[model samples]
Target: MKYIWIYAVIPVVYSIMFFSVRGGFLKSAHMLNIRFLSGLSIDDGSVRTALLVIFAANIAAAVITVTGHLGSTAEDGYLLREDYNGQTYTQNLELSISGEERPIEIEVAPRSYSETEKEAILSRAAMKIESIILEGQSAGHINQDLKLISSYEEMPIVISWVTDRPDILDWDGKICRGIPEEGTDVVLTASLEWGELEKEVTIPLTIFPKELTGDEALREKVNEAVSSSNNSEDEKLILPDKIDGKNVVWHSAGSGQGLIVLFAGLLFAALFMFSRIQNRDIQEAKRQEALLYDYPHLVNKLVLLLNAGMSMRAAFEKTAHDYRISLKNGGPKREGFDEIL
Candidate 1:
């Protein structure tokens, strides 16, 4: 029973000291929430109730923060499928031109082939290459406009052609730019050199005069406007009335300082709580020692009274009575005697 009381009393006393210290600090700076924090300082059942509520709230908040952090990390692609699997995989992740653009699909498969079969596969791949379109031109008219088609691939392609009419359609190393006087079929051979392997493709081209329609002209204008808008310095500013005006600019205000301050406050609170809880056993032991120091004197008085021939109940009652009188008259009170009484 005494051990149980000590266990209960230590926490009760710790709670009082914790709340009083916190309340005094907060009160000094006029930041204390009286309605909430003040209840813990009061010597009543409400203090225990408040502690229970605070503990439950902190646990709930911690759970929510952890869950949210995990969810956001997964959504942002920080978590990968390969993390949980033992198989290796590769992905070509690229940003889309527009949000609605579909991702490019690549397939990987294993096959055993002879050298002849591999050469046949390369030959088939090279024959599949069709006519190459210049950067700004549409696919319909290749002959009317002599546009220089530059190499857009990461590795430059070597172009060589044997045309029936070399004078009409000519090829420079960089670009194919020549106006054909009449409509004629021309064969163009382009080769890509990668390391020691060379892949060649033949392209059939027919050039004719192209007439621009009203809709096509309007489309070209719109394309030009979009391109100019993208390249403009004021692209971030938005002005709906002006077609070339920019969208609104957004600047990020980072939370580094705020996070640092918040973490520091949490660290301080944790340290304070740990310090108070850690010293609880020491404080309880000290209190017990003080009470035990008075035990010898208390036992001696009880022995004297017992030797005086008084009854056991009378002697016990008289001992308690004397302690009460002393306490009431401002005399020193011994904790050991008080417990016995």
Candidate 2:
């Protein structure tokens, strides 16, 4: 009922604007020189167009707010039954015990399945769990982090994972420190539980060391030597002088030579392009000025030939021939004369 008031404001505002404009409220707008309203009059089409736009925009905003606020309802701190589908959606919810507000994502699934169907889901899930843990590696080459899931969201079962080698791979599937150069074998066990039934799935995996490049290996050695040199109780701090039977040299990394060279190249290219464009524009302007300067003389010659009883075509031909003869005698080159010929 409260949300319905949002729609009522749209009609009331539209009616007021219609009556005010149709009456003479905007008649003084032109005399007052108002920015937008000065161009609108009582009988103008713009008056009707502006009213319709305001009416539409208000109705749209009201509809969006009402639907967004009242889409899902709750009673007594629990969600309404009709709002839950099988897919996920979010709702603003408050916890009764903690008095805390939070937006919770909810997904509801059916719990009633026959015993035969439940067994089939678990059987397929066990086979699927192997690929999920491997995460894209083959069974013989596991070097990165594993994807150990606590629950499978697709099915109804809950899973609890365990590993045999805690040093190589922990319970959270993180690859631990100091992995052996050669591979190590580990067994992962998943305990699957659903309502009252339980099942176990075992996956055997071989874990290998991560491959590192030359630079990465050198940095790792330097880091190990620096970490060993730290003594908290000493007065003076010590830095590592050697790492892995090789000498260590430390320098500050603030050299700007590379950036200086890049900027110099860019500046040179921009200046070269600017000079080329300026030269081309100067040549174009000179050609246009030359043509404009020679236009009056050409027009006078054509008028004199036409007044002496020559036909229009003969006058044009005689003008072109005179321009060519002047060019042969040492007259200045004019673009207009060349175009006439």
Give the candidate number with the greatest TM-score: 2
Q: What are the per-residue Cα lDDT tens digits for candidate 2 across 69-108?
A: 5664553345543321254445555434476556656543
Per-candidate TM-score against the hidden true structure: 0.27, 0.38
State the local distance difference test value for candidate 2.
0.76
lDDT score, residue 292, model 1? Answer: 82
Q: What is residue 49's positional error in candidate 1, in angstroms?
A: 84
lDDT of 1: 0.55
State the weakest 10-residue window (summed lDDT) of model 1.
Answer: 150-159
Top of the candidates by lDDT: 2
Pairs clashing within candidate 2: none
Find the 10 residues in a row with the least total lDDT in model 2.
Answer: 80-89
Question: Candidate 2 deviates by what RMSD?
Answer: 18.2
Give the poorly placed runs of model 2, Cα more than 4 Å off: 1-111, 212-219, 227-237, 242-341
RMSD of each: 33.5, 18.2
